[model samples]
Target chain A: MTAQAAQADQLASSHGHLVIIGGGEDKERDMAILKRFVELCGGPSAKIVVVTAASAVCARMWETYDRAFRDLGVTRHVHLHLMTRHDANDEDLIRDVLDADGIFMTGGDQKRLLAIIGGTALDAEMHAALKLRGACIGGTSAGASAMSGHMLAQGRAELHPEKGSVSLGAGLGFLHKVVIDQHFSERQRLSRLLSVVAQNPYLQGIGIDEDTALVVERGVGIEVVGEGAVTIVDGRAMSTNVAEIADHATPELIDVRLHLLPAGSRYGLPGADDRDARRIPPPLLEFLENITKRNPIS
Target chain B: MTAQAAQADQLASSHGHLVIIGGGEDKERDMAILKRFVELCGGPSAKIVVVTAASAVCARMWETYDRAFRDLGVTRHVHLHLMTRHDANDEDLIRDVLDADGIFMTGGDQKRLLAIIGGTALDAEMHAALKLRGACIGGTSAGASAMSGHMLAQGRAELHPEKGSVSLGAGLGFLHKVVIDQHFSERQRLSRLLSVVAQNPYLQGIGIDEDTALVVERGVGIEVVGEGAVTIVDGRAMSTNVAEIADHATPELIDVRLHLLPAGSRYGLPGADDRDARRIPPPLLEFLENITKRNPIS
Candidate 1:
């Protein structure tokens, strides 16, 4: 198939927006990152559902987001409690879930959040809202980590690739083929993300820095929002000593296609057209182009 | 490179197809699942050869399937059996297996079948037929379980998800990343399926219900055919205490994604697309489009 046709086929199935934020989002002042979410949800009038299942202080998490949206002039909003697996499939919540224009998740424990809702009817509805109803789905910190189909559940914060540092789990699947890590720069989690990418290699690891968000447009490219950068670790062509490493041993990662994308930059979705390849964001195309440029035909 | 492109490239190297059926596929009436196997084999003109190595009652199994194929208008159908491991390399059988458009294996003891044919010339020919010369391979029950890279040989039938309830071994290697279990819901083998996946969350466990088939389209998505469901237990991101829990102790499985797909649903090959996640008959998609056609998203 033509590259265009192939890219089109990949995106033909995607019908939603994803707003994945790093931890320590600004709730006060401009609230620029969260406002982008509100705007994507069809402005202040859109009905939004905030899932605070990940938080230990669920009520506080709910109140915080509730007040944030209210200040943004959102008229209709509600908090979804998925404290148990049963609550994730509660019949009464189905209608509200279906009607929602925006589905936002709060930060806390991503593992705890997914444990209750994974594979539940509520999870299905959330998928439906995104895939069928064109909803803008936003998440922060732990919420951001759970957006991937294969989520990186746990890993010790490290600056070097540790063999046994990273632990993975399934996520809500807004994004596939990529694992997200929040508090990237702030937590110095470059190694945690690197560990997974080195082990799998085929999987792309994306680490979102604190106060920043990666806004994924439906079936298109991604835009960086907020103050910090989004670090992408693509190891598809990398060489590593992962296989030779002992348990908890640090491994060497070489020739990995790493990109640190700062705010105000946009990147082409993988395999899509690269009309703006030579732009501010040095993503797939630009990087590949640079390689070709470095070694000229002459 | 795009992961999809990489995956497609890997799958394309194997120019073949697999029609994996759960136990007790219907031979009488419409024989929908078997018909699908025939269709995948390039219709009635296709040469079909059945291997009854797994069955203790080989002749009876052969007769039933032979008659079923004949009724479906297949004229060039034959059965090949291996009474011993030496019989697997019988020169006469080699030509038939290598030339056959479709190679169907019967239900019985997978271990017994493997002991006779594994690594033999006939087994090599089957892989050659599947990989080198594009052929359709259909399997039922034990035939299905032996198709995975790591086959589930034996497991206790249990209703509740239990621990240490599974036994694994090598197989024909038709599918990787998944372990197959036939006679699933009919025999209440969910626990057995869960046991294996929980132990190694990386491997997905697929329990195929009776009279159903999971049609794997090479390098593409999968389509479910027949009367029952295909239960997919994905624990890739599941949080479990398997490491801390003792053997035979029921480990807690958190964040596992489960899907019970019935007839005619299409799922993305390795990565699933939830748009076709629902159970609906084949001819309903057009109706779905017509109903939703009235209103177009702006």
Candidate 2:
């Protein structure tokens, strides 16, 4: 199979849009990020649900997002605060979420957010909404962290990557194939992200800077929005000395492909663009080309 | 959180049954294993669909399984031959699978099975059938390997575990939390399974021997059937020197919990049994207990 055909096969199942934002999205400025979310949610007629489960100040967080949506001319909006697992099973809450055209998650503690809603009825409903109903799922900061199936829960920032500095946890899994990190450049989390990709090269590491968003139109393409750049650390062809690093010690990675994509840049869905201007090594390019040919997915 | 509550929480979302069989299940003798699958599919009235995508000799494979189901007094059984990705997207085929009471997958090459059907309309329909329509999914060997979200694609049979010895791939993901290996004792694949768990301790390792099956009634419990024992390698509490191992070198694992459960033995769903006769280390037991307590799921 050609690379194009293989990418098509990988994307055939995706139907929803994932609007993932980095931390500190400009809500007060032009609100471009939130506007993009509202636009994707089908404009003013969209029924949007904001989940502030991750925030310690749930009510305050809800008010902020609610006001933002209202200012954006969204008429139908609701707030869902699941403090405990039992709340995640509330029929009324589940109904509201199922009826939503879009679901937005706020930033705080991803662990707290997932602990309450992970593997619950609401969680299942959210996935169903995305898969079956084509509803847009948007998140920022901790919210973005909880979008992938395998999430980077917490980690320390260092110039050099470490073996066991980063920890992983289960996310809501709206997106697959990549581990997402927020506040990328501001927090200096490149090392931690590199460490994660070194261990699990199958997963690509996507680091979105503050105020930026990665708009993933399922089965179509991924577009970058907002101010900063989205750093993509591809480790599929990289060699790592991770296994040799002692526990909680620094790790050494070799030949990792890094792509610093600025706002307005887009990549083809399912596979990286082969004709991009960036200079990818011949061997690495051949390796990627072989994946589709060898697999013959379509 | 008590064990019962934790079990309840886990079962809250599980709505289907998965009969995962290791390779070499008896088909000619008493047909005990095949009968179990039919029984789970609702017996004589069961509408079974046999997926022969994994086998090279699809016709012969289909005939063998078709005869087994027919002999078991099954009235409605259809064959689904997904030779290519296009077949997996056939609306008629998806409809047939959607109406299935049971879906049986034959063993050959798991990669072939996934390559043809993974991320297709048929795959989505199958997941919907299991999650919403209460259909049973049963697979043998290659079929069983595709049951988990993270599958142990290929590996060598060695006594001492080595780094980078096993290859992992994406499965259909009907089951989570465990990496399954078939033809366990027959192939001596314990070391590879151990190595996988050491690197990703969040996932448990289950090795099923040939002629054996793990009957997973989602949200309830898993029961062992057929002949031989099922090895459950719990890695959550194990301390591994994996970070210090050289590339492709043997790994050193410490305090890994090994449970050799024979047929007729049952454990609670989600969490391993706490009161088993086999002595689990205090730290491991404490860690297991803390999962339910810390998360307070449901």
Q: A189-227 in candidate 1: lDDT tens per residue?
A: 765887898798767888888889988765456677888
The reply for model 2, stretches above 4 Å from the true place, is: A1-14, A269-298, B1-298
Interface RMS for model 1: 21.4
| Model 2, C-alpha of B231: deviation from truth (Å) | 44
lDDT of 2 by residue, A138-189 (tens): 9999999999879899888754465788888999877666799999866767
For residue A6, give model 2's deviation from the true position in Å: 33
Candidate 1 - CAPRI tier?
incorrect
Worst 10 residues of 1 chain A by lDDT: A289-298
Off by over 4 Å in 1: A1-14, A268-298, B1-298
Give candidate 1's root-mean-square deviation (CA, Å).
Answer: 22.2
By summed lDDT, the worst window of 10 consecutive residues in model 2 chain B runs over B289-298
Cα error of candidate 1 at position B292, Å: 68
Clash statistics: count for each candidate: 2, 1
